[model samples]
Target: MHFDLADLRLFIHIAESPSLTQGAKRAFLSPAAASARIKALESQLGSRLLYRDNRGVDLTPAGQRLLQHARLIMRQVEYLKNEFTAYGADAAGHIRIFANTTAVTEFLPEVLAGFLAQRPGVTVDLQERLSRDIVRGVLDGSSDLGIIAGPVNASGLQVLHFSTDRLVLAVPRNHPLSTLKHVKLKDTLRYQHVGLHEGSTLLSFLREQVEHLGETLSLRIQVSSFEAVCRMVETGVGIGVIPESAAKRHSRTMDLTIIELDEEWAIRERSMLVRDLDALPGCVRALIDTLLPASGAEPPSNTPT
Candidate 1:
């Protein structure tokens, strides 16, 4: 019937961490004290919160439910602290945004730079995550805004057209496919590929598309970013499939050739998603405005294909 903020904070830490000891360390509590707190919290709530095993701990159903509420509560607490602190000085705000790989790598830097330039007191926490994780973060109040690509089941969120891009092949100037203006993915699958890391959204999408065609991509090297992929392709390691914007930019600096893809799914669109636009803070709303494309202007197309 009674609990403190420390208990909730500790509970969240434990649920996220692989072990109670690690969680305790993160919460700045001794292991013994943290265990005692957990026991007391469970007793007061009349439910078990974690399942113990040799590998680590897993959250119980009740613990999962509590975690959702705890995150929301902590976010509100942070907002309150920032709001009150703003009155004593220049109005400063903090906004957290989670975006997928394409948006993070190609789009957000310029948009965020312009926003930060105008509001020197405000700070933005930007993180890169897959589209699905970004959606989950926004839905759970873990992130204030999200920009995602591809088809997303956004039944419960407000969606806006953010930007559009296409996937293209980046081949060395002398590669076999360099002479073609546009080639189908199936045609390119026969050669080795320089791809992004396994968990990257663009790489996963490419794999999914290849699988859908009853084929597999022969990836020769996997790198952390598009720049690395382009660099690898430039050295004749393998061709790379990357966002058109990135390929174009790197082509100027590197001896790489850009070839468009002839697949329908290659034309990707990005959308900005939020839980509720009406409920957003003024600073967040202003950030959204800055991110949105100019009125009556068509979304910038990344490639002619």
Candidate 2:
């Protein structure tokens, strides 16, 4: 069945919020008006879109299926608007991006600084989330572009490798490991470790590597951001592992010692994910040229498995 953008927007909002009232507040419509619109759309579609009980409102099975397509359709509409907007003024379109903590704090500033310098009219709106959430944002059409660590696989979107980073082990400057040029996995694991939350890609990689070495990782703390991890390391809480680039950036205040992981783990790829490569706007094209000039859309990483 055909649907308008407004109908799809309403459906998305309703599906995201637990209650109709919350959805109504987000859409700036009264509770009665919001309920009426939902009912009208349900009538047109000839199906119940939501189910409400003690747990508040939730989308029905059909609603879940429709929401997927609705998101894709809405993304295309936004792409069209951006393309036209770019035509009005060179490099003057909105680029919404979602990035992980490391990408935002360490990677994007230089790239965006150059991008904005070249395209003064273009404005960037950025959302910082975990790597996995950033991928979801790109897949869900909430973000036009995303930068993240690790490998991401999605059906329609294209992934391009923009850079590769070394994952290093960091400890307080005075820690015993600090004097070593390179640390063995066993030596590093002997001390308490600071890790990311369970599902974080960085933690997964480190944990897997440690597990393969027949060692149990002793985690002292699990924080969401690398900055927090560094701060903890400074106070002798635990040694933290993160991207080498990030550790260097924090070296001034963190007073942390960093060493290369002697193991054969492949370097992490810092990649850019876009919905459709060929459909990129001019400003996007310019940014791509700046970031991946000679690479020409490379794969995630060459780190040996």
Ten contiguous residues with the weakest lDDT in model 2: 296-305
Best by TM-score: 1
Q: How close to the true structure is residue 232 of candidate 1, measured as C-alpha lDDT?
A: 97
lDDT of 2 by residue, 98-118 (tens): 876667666578878977887
The TM-score of candidate 2 is: 0.77
Clash pairs detected, candidate 1: none
**Candidate 1 per-residue lDDT over residues 7-54, each given as its tens digit:** 899988888899999899999999899989988988988999888787
Candidate 2 at 34: error in angstroms? 3.0
What is candidate 2's CA lDDT for residue 89?
A: 33
Model 1 TM-score on a 0 to 1 scale: 0.83
> Which model scores highest in lDDT?
1
List the global CA lDDT of all models: 0.82, 0.77
Residue pairs clashing, model 2: none
- Candidate 2 off by > 4 Å: 86-90, 117-121, 172-174, 194-237, 248-257, 293-305
